[model samples]
Structures are given as C-alpha cells and as structure tokens.
Target: MNKASRSTVYDGEVTWQRIADEVGLSRQGAKHVYNKAILKLQKNEQLKQYWVDLIIEGRATKCD
Candidate 1:
C-alpha cells in the first residue's frame, strides 16, 4: 500500500478511486492490494525495508 499510503501520508488524501483510476484497477481491487500490504506489514516484521522498497517500486511502476 505504499502508493495508497503515500496518498494519505504525503498528500493528506486517501482517494482510492483516483488511485484505482490512475493504475487501471477497480476501486475494490486497489483497496484489496492496500489491505494485503497492511497485513504483510503487520505479520512480516523481518526484512521490513525490503518489502517497503518492493512496494515503492511497484508503485513507481504503476502497480505493474
């Protein structure tokens, strides 16, 4: 959820609809991705930076 969380953290907004539109995903799909990220962050404490970098890269690549 790096991109989605970036919306809230950096832009002070959490527009899932706009994110979905920009990345060509359904709104629910975007939310699903974000939720999965959340679970990962909570459950996988080790290698946090690795997962974070991966998430940011995914966002940079437009969720590809």
Candidate 2:
C-alpha cells in the first residue's frame, strides 16, 4: 500500500499488478493480502495504535 501510495505508474497511482510483481504474488493474491491487512488493523486496536504512534514518532524525528 505504501508503494501504491507513492507510485506514479497509473496517472500517479500504482496498480495491483505492480504490487503483485514486487511481492511475487498474483494480482488477486496481492489484493487479498492488502484486504487482510486492513481487516487486521481494524480489528486490533492496540496494533493500530502502535503503528499510529510509530508514524507520529517518525514524523517528529523527520522534522527534527
């Protein structure tokens, strides 16, 4: 998803095909993985907050 967000291939958006190729999975498999990750993040509040905190820390460090 990060790669997709940063990609510029499809009019500034990356395709599932690109993600699949990078990860050695079929396009459908890549989509499945992405969906599964989203579900996990949604269902696990602690895990989600951990990542949110990490992102905030990363931004703070980057700014310094």
TM-score (C-alpha, index-matched) for candidate 1: 0.54
Best by TM-score: 2
Model-by-model lDDT, in order?
0.77, 0.82
**lDDT for each residue of candidate 2 in 5-60, tens digit (9 for 90 to 100):** 45544434588998887778999999999999888988999989987999899779
| Candidate 2 displacement at residue 41 in angstroms | 0.4
TM-score between model 2 and native: 0.61
True-structure lDDT of candidate 1: 0.77
Ten contiguous residues with the weakest lDDT in model 2: 4-13
Screening candidate 1 with a backbone cut-off below 3 angstroms (N, C-alpha, C), the clashing residue pairs are: none
Candidate 1, residues 14-56, lDDT tens digits: the string is 5899779766899999999989987887787775777879879
Off by over 4 Å in 1: 1-10, 47-64
TM-score each candidate. 0.54, 0.61
* Highest lDDT against the true fold, candidate: 2
